[model samples]
Target chain A: SKSNEPPPAPPVVHYYMNNLTNTRTPIENSETVLILTPLAKFYQEYWDNLLKISYPHDLVSLGFIIPKTKEGNAAYSELQAQVTKTQSGPKTKRFASITILRQDTESPLQSQSEAERHKMENQKVRRAAMAKARNSLLFTTMGPTTSWVLWLDADIIEFPPTMIQDLAAYDVPIIAPNCFQRFYNEEEKKNDIRGYDFNNWIDSPTARDMASKMGKDDILLEGYAEMATYRSLMSKMYDPQADPGTKVKLDGVGGAALLVKAEVHRDGAMFPPFAFYHLIETEGFAKMANRLNWESFGLPNYLVYHYNE
Target chain B: SKSNEPPPAPPVVHYYMNNLTNTRTPIENSETVLILTPLAKFYQEYWDNLLKISYPHDLVSLGFIIPKTKEGNAAYSELQAQVTKTQSGPKTKRFASITILRQDTESPLQSQSEAERHKMENQKVRRAAMAKARNSLLFTTMGPTTSWVLWLDADIIEFPPTMIQDLAAYDVPIIAPNCFQRFYNEEEKKNDIRGYDFNNWIDSPTARDMASKMGKDDILLEGYAEMATYRSLMSKMYDPQADPGTKVKLDGVGGAALLVKAEVHRDGAMFPPFAFYHLIETEGFAKMANRLNWESFGLPNYLVYHYNE
Candidate 1:
């Protein structure tokens, strides 16, 4: 039988950053940080931050560009200029040099009719962009210097400097910081404010009796509390006697602000190839953890306000 | 490893005729036969036939009288008289003594109140009848008699007189004859002569395909041709890629006709308590045969028409 015991922690922290438009201010000790961006604007923003933070660390910023068509070559001339700008700078002697990487693009189908051709070309562009980000993350982590890889979404803004340290405190194989909906209150608070009079939705007397049996502590959070109340009032709900809880253990947690250990990636853990974007990574991570018998937990006490709007 | 080989055949055929009524019947000379009955009308009709058939067998007619309620003592006394009459008969002198049995009136509920109560009552009656017959058959076959036990439905009328000999020819542990619906090709011939397309009545195209695949040769009679076609079509519909040439084994044949070796009964091969009616009995028999890894097949060539109308 495989051991369910947790693995030991790694020594260093490695952050894997993906950029869409432009980067924010960078951290100190740049050698410890690896910034991966696609747009030229993002590279310029990082260059500004490099001057500002002035910390002694290695920095590798890979600027990815997809060629327009199969006939067109992926020109590194534009990326080479950005690389020259960073290396030839006054603080160049501090840490490792910044490298600009461009992903090669295959041509979209040219034979199809104009409408069909446009749609296919658009699809090819999106796939190439995704492939670039996934491959870059994989390649950087494959090196010996990397320990843990932190995935930061392209649009995140207000994250604390000690965010990495907070994640490290868990010492668990996989840790995810609580990414709260910035404007929304917790579920319990929302339920309290609603103050609905009627208890249960279903009118079964037996259900009403069961609902009376529930203690206040069992109410959980707001939306969940209402759901539990409704179920308690509905006698026709699934019998508690039938739920023998010895299966896969999971309460509930979302996959944003996730921090994964190096060993998980070394064991060939990968995101599932799904067409949909949001839940694909989350589900893949959960399934991988289950397969490897790794424990995963979310720290609700440590919340991150994601400023997407 | 358990033996997958079929059992060798017995030398003699054993027949158990269950008289499903209360009238006393004189039986003589037969090695062993159990006649089970509950009502009186059916008992009188088969008395003479029972006497003639029992000539080469040791026969025992078992009767059961059910009380109206737990408080009714008069009903119990009446049951005793009915059982005593058959046991004292002169014709039964050369055969095993007749026995009577009754279900406990005050037994606790063993089935669900809604659907299982009716089913449980029917099973109780049938099991009591079968158990008494099994005990008598075992007793007669033990002493100076080489016999096999055949279980026959009490309402069976169209059985051929040479049914025993036909069953005896099989060099297997059990023999089951092919059963057909009483009504034959009359409706089909009338429809065909009238130039009516009866095929339209079959709603599912798959069912029609199945009927055609089984073919006329595989079907014993014209009436059952549709059913054979349906079975063939249904199998294909479930798994289209499955091999068409492979023969699919059925769970159970209908219980209109059944024959078993006496030793099987003697060695405690009694019918399970669940099968009260023909459908249930057939299902139970099939399940038991499957558990023992015994081969059970319908004799396709010889068909018995069970007349219900």
Candidate 2:
């Protein structure tokens, strides 16, 4: 499809000054494409909190993946009951049908050689498994009318009633709220607030450099690169009581609490069941979203609290 | 192509944190795909300066587009001679075939209605035209072995002989050098160094918000949005005489000079002929590359300078 010839050179002039901004499009209310691919055991806490969200649930089309872990089938059975009880509403409600899927865990890992499995890092397998599970949740569950997808982890122990409304206020393509938990302070001897999750961070240049040297399956999970990474540059703000509006650029996203624009998935960004840019699962999705010019960020204030061991 | 069903619900947990870094695979002596599409009046300057590069010319597969403008045919004819003279080398060199192509410029503006043309912001048409021309250049000229494609505008008059090496040193997917010019003092001007390009920036939230609202044909060219943009955040380095190693993150790319890894192009990123997310042409290509997980940057110390009238 190319011309094979030595065409003559051209006389050139310096015509070079370029600038244009993208038009501003404002939306009063964007429909939710809520997706929950949780592997937690607390069905009641997750479901009850889902009802507590200040936003109208009728506008929300829900989906989740029942990963084929040991407790997966039992969790699916109970969740079905919960959905049946919760499904009925007035005629004005336009909620699309609910969706649920299961992991095809028929010894998929057996496909790998014994040697390969033995050498595989635990984190890598877990990431791949989770990524696969999340992929199942999205591809099998997403409805056409959805505009945004809020990813929620099952183990969230506490949160305000206004989380969905608060995160939507940022209005960026992808966003993660800080996940923290209260614990008996070993030092203070009292319950204290802590910014517990380290997954969402602003990476240092060294981490960026070290990334290329790692294997595709070797994901850069948080709490591991703390020495080299700034680990949530927003954390440097040093305020446990930070304002809700605060946000920062993110290198990775924790699955616990996230809000994603559905258009990202519609544009072909998915949780890679395998490594993508050395990241899998949620981080891989974040990478995929960033690559597509839909920027990702994390809120500094804790919008949702996670269960502590 | 996607499933739509309201299957049973699944219990989900906070299988929350995930991270992975892209591996940095270093390449040594990647082959060059040099391209320049010019209007042809400055043919002599373009040819001579090209011969001055330190990298082996024999290793380059040069290509260009001569539009159907007035001097376009004449420029193509002369470039054929220059290619012949400069093409000879030992067998060890890896030069691929040279290429030349043409643009259908017969009243390109004639297609636009007179009222529409009068109301049009010139940047929109320029960006669209340039994007189309560049796409044609790459689609028509690039060969299989090309690992890198260096886009050079005809107006660039000065650059390091090690220009390629310096840029490749960053080892990222996409990069651009700061373009500037030396202007003599008509009165108080003592050959002041003017940093010519302002498209590169660290985007603020307002600009990001404004992006989705803009039309596709609307291109943010340099100098036009100095007030709205965080213009050339790298230009604050305050180095009229800084070293070449200095660099910074870029939000937009200037057309005067740019270096791109070919795989980014091969992976479906190109100068989008139509508007893509409020950007078209070079900036759109940068956006596309970034979406595919390639980081783009700019060198602050002027690696190249453009010619003035």
Each candidate's number of clashing pairs is 28, 42
The alpha-carbon lDDT assigned to residue B18 of candidate 1 equals 22
Query: Model 2, stretches more than 4 Å misplaced?
Result: A1-30, A88-96, A106-120, A225-228, A233-238, B1-309
Q: State the C-alpha RMSD over the true interface residues for candidate 2, after superposing those residues.
A: 20.6
CA lDDT of A214 in candidate 2?
A: 84
* Interface C-alpha root-mean-square deviation, candidates in order: 38.6, 20.6
Model 1 clashes, total count:
28
| lDDT by residue (tens digit), candidate 1, A1-309 | 012111121211111111101112223222133333332123333333334433333433222322334322223344345445655555543334332223332333433232453353243333334433343334322222234445543223334545555665555666655453334347655521111111111223443455456552121111233233232211122233543211222222233355555445433343422211111233334444444456665553344443322
Q: What lDDT is reached at residue A286 by model 1?
A: 43
Q: What's the DockQ of model 2?
A: 0.02
The DockQ assigned to candidate 1 is 0.01
lDDT of 2 by residue, A156-253 (tens): 76777677767777778788887877678988788876766666777677667667788644556555534364454544444656565778888777
lDDT of 1 at A242: 49
Give the chain B TM-score for each candidate.
0.44, 0.78
Per-prediction DockQ comes to 0.01, 0.02
Question: Candidate 1 on B61-166: residue-level lDDT in tens?
Answer: 2323232244224444543444345444554433353322222222333332323433533444443333333322233222112244455543344445556556
Candidate 1, residue B136: lDDT:
24
Error of 1 at B14 (Å): 22
